[model samples]
Target chain A: MRVVVPVSGSDPKTRLASVLTPDERRDFTDAMLADVLDALTGAGLEPAVVSTAPVDCDAPVTVDERGLDALVNDLLASTVDEAGGALAIVMADLPLATPESVDRLVSTDGDVVLAPGLGGGTNAFVCRHPDFRVDYHGASIRDHRRIARDAGVDLSEVDSRRLATDIDEPSDLAEVLLHGDGAAADWLADAGFEVALTDGRVAAVRK
Target chain B: MRVVVPVSGSDPKTRLASVLTPDERRDFTDAMLADVLDALTGAGLEPAVVSTAPVDCDAPVTVDERGLDALVNDLLASTVDEAGGALAIVMADLPLATPESVDRLVSTDGDVVLAPGLGGGTNAFVCRHPDFRVDYHGASIRDHRRIARDAGVDLSEVDSRRLATDIDEPSDLAEVLLHGDGAAADWLADAGFEVALTDGRVAAVRK
Candidate 1:
């Protein structure tokens, strides 16, 4: 009934140096965490965003007092102690990730449900019980799946495109520009961020 | 066969600000531009990378030494005067953009070939004559298409997936990391740029 979204504001692999100014990158991950919280709250779920990195938010969400991974484990532990039953750990970068997908991921009858990334790594994991401890950093998707198999948890894959996509690179942002239209797109237009997404600029700046 | 690639590097959108580090954004765009140049050169075309915004490059690309719009205009003039033929103005953020697609854009017989973006913006434009100037920026895709219509030049539409996608937001980057592979994918991975591109991190980030 509770979801823990632990965000490590650092993804050295999917950094946004080219498209984002320094300040933009600094605040982006936190905002995304907020958005995920929004999505969860909208879906009538109690959402807790555990920030691995420092962030300030006016949202009614709870920030973990522990490290990101540790906070996630604690959330699971607390959930078990309180008979919370089910817990979901969601990543924040999936812009298209929807609440319906999260519900499906959590509702699946598995001791642990692994929502794998498009690359074969898991993006999210739902644990029915807190007896299993997990290591969720460094190719965490693969690691979690292995753990799920080892624990003999009934594992299910939710092939939701919305839940699968997480933005980290410049080109990935372009895809949202191409398909998404909303406050995010309008904000992009207003921010003069189109240069990185425009084709003319793309062709001109080739190596 | 002088090609004009109008390049612009813009700040990251507020929404994606949370998901990307500044370096990741820069590296993603830089790698995309590099790929665009490689495709152009590999296709045996002379590329004049007109950096619409001021920038430095690691390649022997021509930085539009003048102002962004002016430099594009000058490049257009020079190419028109030299070749006495058509010139192509392509965008730069398309990381997966291919030379074959570029060739297709150029191969079309028309006073202008407009390759529309997914958002109905023009990604690639081929000007058949020197006198017909493209707006080159802003809602120029529609403007260029209208210009082609007025010029009575055969307006050709090449709907290329590679050409259509541009990174305008953080979510867009997620789509790229989800679908893109090969050099751009490898470069993103090697550079430690993680955007979920695959079903997993594209496992869509490192895969």
Candidate 2:
């Protein structure tokens, strides 16, 4: 099984712009990537980083400038040519992910295993069937299920909070500060970001 | 099609005891139940509450003191006798659930449509196949998948944060106050519980 962690090296986590500067977002993205790599390595999987631009990490980084959908679909197609090989794609923004959750996701038996993110995104997936490909656009989890169904393959899902909680909006930073215990959490804390309540809502605020 | 929201009417939300008193826990449970009921009704489905004890709500309440697995299994069996009928079970503690998410859960096509909760519980499910029974023991979502596979039925999952985020621990209260807009959120505010950062972690603290 080849595990791949896809990241956007440039201008990532734009939704967090209100709280994080561009440089901070880039640094925070690296921190999240490091956390993901640590979890994958902890799960005993040697993962490769596939990013839109150059990134510095412990794992081997492949700078694929293509879009997410194209990059992932191409990776899936190449795996199909390998004849009986599995590919696992995990997004890099899941700061709360632990080794056990990633292990459950990969060890599950199915033609395709999907770990759906919050608000209908495919955070991570394991594709064992050659006919299976990915489409990470517009409710991608639902689309993946339909794609697997159309290909006449059995699909399974790993329902995990750690894998589902991708860092997207500014509001999502609170989850990292609360449940995360990785480099991303350390980065946020070092950057003077902490969870705070303002006007009946909990969010990550800079002091 | 029939919709059921199963709630534990006696000493519910025990995990919340650290922050809420016994009476407060009961009241908070009722508020969460009302939120679930409102979401169901808003989705154009008239739902019934099957509880362990008497409860007050807008929907009809049926007190079934049996365990969760037995109660849900019996409900599935009863639905089998209805001849091509479907049953949807949504947990009462999912205060973040919205009407649109519930609508998607039921409207989706599958023998068993599961909305898995965080930490391996099945928060909500729609069963169209008669042979499918539930076991709400350890890792209920995985058990349900195996059960569906053993029965030779297609299982689909709704990977929704709203349905997945069940209010269990005191930390979960922040989610209700953040993303929730129902009676449960109102109850938390009325009870003087607000989101606060304590010891670098976010939690629902009493003001």
Best by TM-score: 2
CAPRI classification of candidate 1:
incorrect
Please list the residue runs of candidate 2 whose C-alpha ends up more than 4 Å from where it truly belongs after superposition: A198-201, B1-91, B95-207
Q: Report clash pairs, candidate 2.
A: none
Q: What are the DockQ scores of the candidates, in order?
A: 0.07, 0.06
Listed per model, the TM-scores of chain A against the true chain A are: 0.77, 0.96
TM-score for each of the candidates: 0.46, 0.57
Question: Each prediction's Cα lDDT score?
Answer: 0.60, 0.85
Question: Candidate 2: which docking quality band?
Answer: incorrect
Q: State in Å the error of residue A187, model 1.
A: 3.3
Estimate, for each residue in B157-206, the C-alpha lDDT of model 2 and write its tens digit.
76566898899887788777756788999999999987664432246778
Top candidate, metric lDDT: 2
**Tens digit of per-residue lDDT, candidate 2, span A1-207:** 889999998999887888889999999999999999999999999999998899999999999999998998888888754656899999999988888788989998999999877655788999988888787765566689899999998898775777988998777887787667899999999999886644323467788
